[model samples]
Each structure stands twice: as structure tokens, then as C-alpha cells.
Target: MSVKHDWYQSEAKVVITVLLRNAAEKHYAVEISGQRVHMTADDYELDLLLLHPIVPERSSHKAYSTKVEITLAKETGVRWEALEKPAAAAAAAAPPKAQAKNWDKLVSEEEKVEEKEAKGEAALNNLFKKIYSSSSPEVQKAMNKSFSESGGTVLSTNWGEVSKEKVTVKPPEGTEFREWDK
Candidate 1:
């Protein structure tokens, strides 16, 4: 059989339940430290280091048919934000040891110039889109259809650098159109 344990906290205390199937009642032992809870069931031991302080004197436990329930009194009524300290946060909190800097991995002057040029191009493209969207509805619809049909790579010839041209409208001419004309 394997030993399993779970823990939860209430307004006043933290309760830990250990599942020990087919184990004798006298075979379990529970202990508490200033900020830790330890339990032994059959041959298995569980150690839980609490994030907050607890009152060992006020802590109690009860053994049931196949489980042991331990209640640890909270030193303060305030709820604990977490049960255990996060290992990643602890590692990040520590100041890194100073090391020699590597100049080879740094960004080159040419790359900086290219990055600035890319930003300027992006800003100009945004301005062009704003101007196109604020144009007349006919122009917007023609541009939308042109862009959709050509995957936006084919530019609209109606609008040029210094002049705005009108879109040519053509009626559909086919057998299906003649039948629908009725």
C-alpha cells in the first residue's frame, strides 16, 4: 500500500489528511515544528514545510479507519497566500554573481540603423492605412476587393501618389444575369 496526503486551510487552522489503507491505528505518528508538519504512516513519512508560522501547542489530530487527520492552529487568523515558497522566485531573488561581459554578443551599429529604419517604415505604413480607411466608401470597397483577390500584394491603381482616381463600374453580362433580370 502507498501513503498519500492532502492539505487545506480554514479560517483558523490548516488540516492535513493522510491516507494509509489497511494500516493499524497505533502505527502512525504526527509531529509539528515551528513552520513544518511531519507525519509517519506505516513505513511512509511526509514532511510539509509551511509558508507561515503555526501554533504547535494548539494543533491536534485524530486517526480514523484508514486515515489520519491533523489540524494545525494558525498563529494568526490571516490566511496564507501560498503553502510553500516557489523555488523559481527564490532563485530569482538572489543577486547573480558578477561576471566578465562579452562584447561579441552585443548588437552591432549596422543592426541598430536597420532597426530604426524598420520602425520608420512601419509608422509610414500605419499612416497610409489610416488615410485609406478614412477615404470615400467607394474607394474603400474597391481597395478591399482588390486586396482580397490579390492577397493584398496587388495595389489599387485608382489612388496614386499625387492624385485620387475614380473606380470604373461594369455591369455583369452572362446567361445567368439575363435569367435573373426577370
Candidate 2:
């Protein structure tokens, strides 16, 4: 005896129930929407329900009891035409102007040059002061020695050494050697 299968049995709007079985013989049920009228025996897999049309002459009694898979129609979310005035207004706000390509480079170069020139002038002034100061010959010799060792005319010594006063010897009170010996 031959059995005849109907295509309308799997048509759209029909809900299909699938049973899932694991290695432990546990069964899980899942439902899927069958919008298409055409379905085939090969279209169904283990726990998967074909919701769309398939080729003709396919059996509908196929068993799918392993894993259930379902496909649903894509949904349209948040239509742009329905947006409120606040969202449109924010998007309409003017954008900031584009920056000049070389502006920052030019500014940084000018600053570096100015800094170098200022340092050079300060160094020259310090060297002039050390060479012409009214300090003692010993201190002057020391400054010149340091300048020569550094290989540059700029005098970078600390102000304390350059401005220190020379120490002078004084006789102790009530202890004059010349008078005490007599």
C-alpha cells in the first residue's frame, strides 16, 4: 500500500512542533512558523522544522528529534521617519571647522627658535660678566679654568662661587705674639 502526502499540511501560518532528544533520551519541544506550503522530507533535520516552501513530493512524516532550529521573519526597529524633533535638531547642528594643516607645526618651530635665541643671549651675557668682574685674580683664574675646560665661552658657574668674598686673617683678642714674647 502507498501513502499520499499533502503539501498544504506544511503551509504558512501553520505551527510545527519539533522534539529534541539527547543521549539521555530526554525530549524538548519547540514550535516554528511554517509560512510556505511546499516542504520535502530532506528539508527537515534532527529537531529542525522547515518553515519555508520546499520541493514537491517530499514526505511530511519525517522525524526530527535531535536539535530544534527555527527561523523567523526579520523585524524592522525604530523607523527614522518617525523620529521626534529633538533627534533631528541635534543632527542638524553645525559641525566644527577643519584645522589648518601646518598651523601647529609652524607655531612649535617658532617657539623653539625663540627659546634657543634667548638662551644664547643669556649665555653670552654671563660669559662677559665673568671675564670682566672685579673679583680677585685667584677667583678669576678659577673661572677661566672652568670655562676653558668646558670648551665653550659661556660661563655656567653658580653665583655663590663667583660672588663669594675672600677670607682675611685677624689677631686673637689679648694674644698678640709680638707683645707677649717681650
Separately for all candidates shown, the number of backbone clashes (residues 3 or more apart, or on different chains) is 0, 4
lDDT string for model 2 (37-62, tens) is 22222323222223233332322323
Q: Which ten residues in a row have the lowest lDDT in candidate 2?
A: 1-10
Per-model TM-score, in order, reads 0.44, 0.17
Stretches off by above 4 angstroms in model 1 are: 22-26, 88-182
TM-score of 1: 0.44
Writing each residue's lDDT as its tens digit, candidate 1 over 1-182 gives 23566667998998877777644654877788777676676667666667788999999988888788889899999787665444464344333211222334454555456555766767667555766868887667666665555444444635342134433333345422132357
Clashing pairs in 2: 12-34, 12-35, 38-54, 47-67
